[model samples]
Target: MKVQNIRMTATKKLIEEAFTDLLRKKGIEKITIKNITERAKINRATFYAHYEDKYQLFDEMIKGAATELINVHTKEENIWNQKQVTCLTQAVFEYLNQVKMSCPYSYQNLFPLLRMKMLNALKTHLESLFNSNNISEIKEFNILMYSRIIYDAAEVLVVEKTNLTYTEVIEEISEIILDNNQSF
Candidate 1:
């Protein structure tokens, strides 16, 4: 059972890497199951066994990446703080930067999907933080609002590729959150 699980994991990783490579080279719209299977060196049946279709593969990849980012960034603490927020902002910026560099041609095509996935991940993390902290003063809506605010602010820096340092961006985001928290 353990060996089977490891093999399945390895196969999925290979398929995902192949999909990413094809996405970088040919963009999402042009890539097909055949392209992915050829790149992955896997049969169509194996691909179908893992994913129903290309859309499912894409979505699973995005969600997996999002979960990974969240896990890596939030490994230490459940409470939200400026430092954690800074780390999250920097991690996101770095991730986006890598995506831009690696898939310059497909970055624009992939940005919307990446943005939505990242935002959902951020929101999930923030909700967990809020719930764990037992911040009864802040409403659920406010937590959602703050999550969007943090995501949008960081996203602007990422999309613009501003010259601002991560620390500078972090400071700005901290202020935004602090100011908003005061109101709530």
Candidate 2:
């Protein structure tokens, strides 16, 4: 059973890697199941066993990436502070930059999906932070608004491939969050 689990994990990783590679080369719209399966060195049966279709696989991949990205900046007992906020913004910027660099062509194709996933993850983390701080005045809607602002800023930076340094972006976002939260 353990070996089977390990094999399943390995197969999934291979499929993911192959899909990423194909996405980079052919872009998502052009990538077919045959393309992914051929690149993964797996059959259609294996692909179907792992994912219903390319869209499902892509959705899962984006969600997984967003979760990992959020985890990188959050701790078990994350404190809601400017520094942590800065770090979170920095993480988002760096993650998006990495994605842009790694998959230039496909990045544009996948930006909307990636942005939404990242935004949702960011909003969840921000809500947790706000709740932990006992900031009862700040509603869920406010938190969502803040998350959207940060996400949009980060998206613009990534899409533009701006000349601004990570620190500059981080500081700006941190200031925005700190300033807005002070009202609560």
Clashing pairs in model 2?
none
Determine which window of 10 residues in candidate 1 has minimal summed lDDT: 175-184
User: What is the alpha-carbon lDDT of model 2 when measured against the actual structure?
Assistant: 0.78
The model with the greatest lDDT is 2
Model 1, 1-184: lDDT tens digits are: 9999999999999999999887777767788999999999999999999999987988887666765766787688667778777767765766676677766667767777787787777777777777788887877776667666766666677677677776787887788776655553
Look at candidate 2 and tell me the lDDT of residue 6.
97
Clashes of each: 0, 0
Q: Candidate 2: minimum summed lDDT over ten consecutive residues — where? A: 175-184
Q: What TM-score would each prediction reach against the true structure? A: 0.80, 0.85
- Model 2, span 1-184: residue lDDT tens: 9999999899989999998888677678888999999889999999999899998988877676776777877664377666776667766777787778777777787777777788888888888787778889888887787777677777777787677786787677667766765553
